[model samples]
Target: MNLKVIAFDADDTLFINEPYFEEAEKKFCVLLEDYLSHQGLSRELFTTQVNNLPLYGYGIKGYILSMIEAAIKVSNGTISVDFIKKITEYGKDLIEKPIELIDGVEETLQALHGKYKLVVATKGDLKDQQRKLHKSGLGNYFHHIEVMDDKQEINYQKLVKRLDIQPSEFMMIGNSLKSDVLPVLEIGGYAIHIPFHTTWEHERIDHKVEHQNFSAVEKIIDVLKILQ
Candidate 1:
């Protein structure tokens, strides 16, 4: 009952998204091979660069732009305009599709709606994330929704200050140990981590959790027992 706000992460935390990107990657690879054959760009090299794009951060625009630039580089500026257009269109399609909300998210949010202030703090492509939130229909449950550029220690502090809530009074619920749990705990906030069934390999990391304020769970519905 002491909780003032509960901030949730979108994407894997609330719904399924990784699969879409994986599917898009397949389409992108095909386009790359077709357009870069003359420059001797192997599929393996293209895959390496595409997979590494996450290093620049997650966003549809950034991902597409980087892929286009890479294609241009490998093709020695001989790549066709249509190839870029196809990849960009594919990226847009990835976002425009409906999202599959994780089981129990809707019910859990409804249970906590009036009891505690609700918010969504997610990181990724702005347009894709925003559209997902809108499509999820859980948008109305949250008082505020933040689409962050990066989930670093400073970002956590900024969110706490923006929401005008003390660390002890707010809780972050998410799936990623690195981005979701660590940064929040670093600032003295509480966090409940629910690991997603499947995660991108690049997002993988080991987290050392020694804080009494942080706990991990297997599912979102389980939080109701703690809060109630």
Candidate 2:
């Protein structure tokens, strides 16, 4: 493959992300357990988050709002402000959470650094993503960072255009097959799925993905074998 640009999906692909969110979600469910069962609250929160995606895009701020919205809905619009404050705190803590790189992430990046133009191509609130990337100490390795609103076929097409590379010369590596893999492949770019143990419900795909340009590896470092 004549790859010119190697783009990575930042969140779970590069560092620990979803597990923290899952922990916060567990707390959210417990805080509202008096109004609804844990399972029920989870369902409500997930539904609210998905519904609010177009409006809030993606980030801790949107998540805090979704938590409050779900809590209010579960409490029949009578949820207390104290509860809201606690929810806000949860979101803030997430925003400040430490960046813990995946086991082989830095090693992989170091190996591939000069061989190609590396960039981060992930979707989320721009400021928050920028903060995480800065904190990760992996920023210098990337030539650019693209915090997309959403990862779709058109978005990938636009990214390819912006990079001035042919679709065939772009390769995306990420954990979510739904967001990071399918869209890149749809736009004729190569995709490598490095499965994270936890994934957001909205990013889960129900079926297997098979394509000539798609491959799944057990870990981030495995990409070196394929790319080299």
Q: What Cα-based lDDT does every candidate model obtain? A: 0.80, 0.95
After superposing candidate 2 on the true structure, give the runs of residues whose Cα lies further than 4 Å from its correct spot.
Answer: none
Spell out the clash pairs found in candidate 2: none
Which pairs in model 1 have colliding backbones?
none
Candidate 2 per-residue C-alpha lDDT over 73-182 given as tens digits, one digit per residue, 9 for 90 to 100: 99999999999999999999999999999999999999999999999999888999999999999999999999999999999999999999999999999999999999
Q: Report the Cα lDDT for candidate 2.
A: 0.95
Return model 1's CA RMSD, one decimal: 3.7
Best by TM-score: 2
lDDT of 1 at 60: 68
- Local lDDT at 187 for model 2: 83
Backbone clashes (count) for model 2: 0
**Model 2: how far is 12 from its true place, Å?**
0.6
Per-residue lDDT of 104-223 in model 1, one digit per residue for the tens? 999999999999999999988777787888888888999998888788889988998999988778899998888888888888888999988777665668756778888888899998
